[model samples]
Target: MSKVRKVTDKILEAVSIFILGIMTVLVVYQVVTRYVFNSPSSWSEAVVTYGFIWLAMFCGAYVFGKRDHMAMTFILDKFKGKAKVAVEMINEFLILLFAVGVLLVGGYFGALKQMTQADSILPISMGVIYIAIPAAGICMLIYFICNEWDLVQRLKGMKEKEKEEE
Candidate 1:
């Protein structure tokens, strides 16, 4: 599991870096064209905007994968043993629910609804851009599942130790 996660993390990191690099280049080009040449590229701005949107979505998923998202840990810090594990499990479950319900389902429908709508500047359908939502949702869901699996394994180990002690 850890091996798979490591590989997945590396892949996501590379993709995130690639997207950021591209976005930077595109923005620079847009600026040079608009200010220096005095002939703004319409497609550049649209592409940058869409790229940013996708990058943001992927970054969010990456953050979740790293388990580095903001959290109010003061109260949680006081917990120990099973209590701490329980709290963490609950937190993971809530995140799972959100990713599956809000992100996956909602994002899919949102993109589907936009399938017929075309971007004003770009030739692609709006759905193309909106697809990022569900893709990120899947990424988040996968990370959450991995976390849950780890927690479950810990719980089983604890149970086994308890039985041995008894």
Candidate 2:
């Protein structure tokens, strides 16, 4: 399971890096065309905008997998032992629910609705752009499941250590 997670993690990391690289190149190209060439490329601007959307969505998912998300853990910090594990599990479940309900379902509909529409500057269907939402949701769901599994294992290990000590 962890090996699968590691492989997915590496893939996501590579994708994140690739997206950032594309964004950087596009912005640079836009800057060069606008200033140096004295002709702004509208297509480049649109592509950059869309690229940023993809980058943000993908990176958001990638970071979630990396467990680099922000949290207000003040109350959670107070819990210890089984209570801590329970609180963490609940937190993960809530996140999983949000990922499914909001990102997966809502995003799928949102993207489908945009299928007929095209961006002003770009010729591609807007649905292609909006698809990132659900993709990110799927990524998040995978991470949450893995996290829950890890937490359960930790709880088991803690219980085993407790038994050993006694």
Candidate 3:
């Protein structure tokens, strides 16, 4: 079980890192060619732009996994017992729903639109750019699920403790 979880985490981390690395390399290569070689290919700009879309989405998912997704702790710290649990669950569920909606509806339509369009500079299909939305949404959903499960267990434990005190 531990091994499986580790593998999953590594996969998510690697993919996020790889997307960011590609973006950096592409931009750097483009700059070098335009300035040093004195002739930059038009395709380089398109590749860099598309790579950035993937990088930003993946980075958002990475933030969720790390539990560093800009949360407000003061409000949560003030609540105790079932109230806290409910608030936490609701927050997680809302996030999960949003990710699922984007992954399913927005992603589907976006991919369709992309496939139909002709990219101005690159001969590559636009589907490549739109696919990142769904891919990152899935990753964000996975992180939400994992984090929600852990929170639910803690909430249950807190309830049990409060009952014992009463």
Which residue pairs show backbone clashes in model 3? none
TM-scores of the models, in the given order? Answer: 0.91, 0.96, 0.84
> Per-residue CA lDDT of candidate 3, range 85-159, in tens?
778888888877888897756886798888978788888678877888888787777777777777878888987
Tens digit of lDDT per residue, candidate 1, span 41-101? 8898889889999988888988888899999999889998778888999998898888889
RMSD of each: 1.8, 1.0, 2.4
Candidate 3 Cα misplacement greater than 4 A, ranges: 1-5, 163-166
Clashes of 2: 0
Which regions of candidate 1 fall more than 4 Å away from where they truly are? Answer: 157-166
Q: Which prediction has more favorable TM-score, 2 or 3?
A: 2
The deviation in Å at residue 31 for candidate 3 is: 1.7
Assess the local accuracy of residue 41 in candidate 3 as a C-alpha lDDT between 0 and 100.
Answer: 62
lDDT of model 3 at position 120: 85
Q: What is the C-alpha local distance difference test score of each model?
A: 0.89, 0.89, 0.78
lDDT of model 3 at position 26: 81
Candidate 1 steric clashes:
0
Superposed Cα deviation of residue 73, candidate 2 (Å) = 0.9
Ten consecutive residues with minimal summed lDDT in candidate 1? 1-10
Question: Could you tell me how far off, in angstroms, the CA of residue 64 lies in candidate 1 after the best superposition?
Answer: 0.6
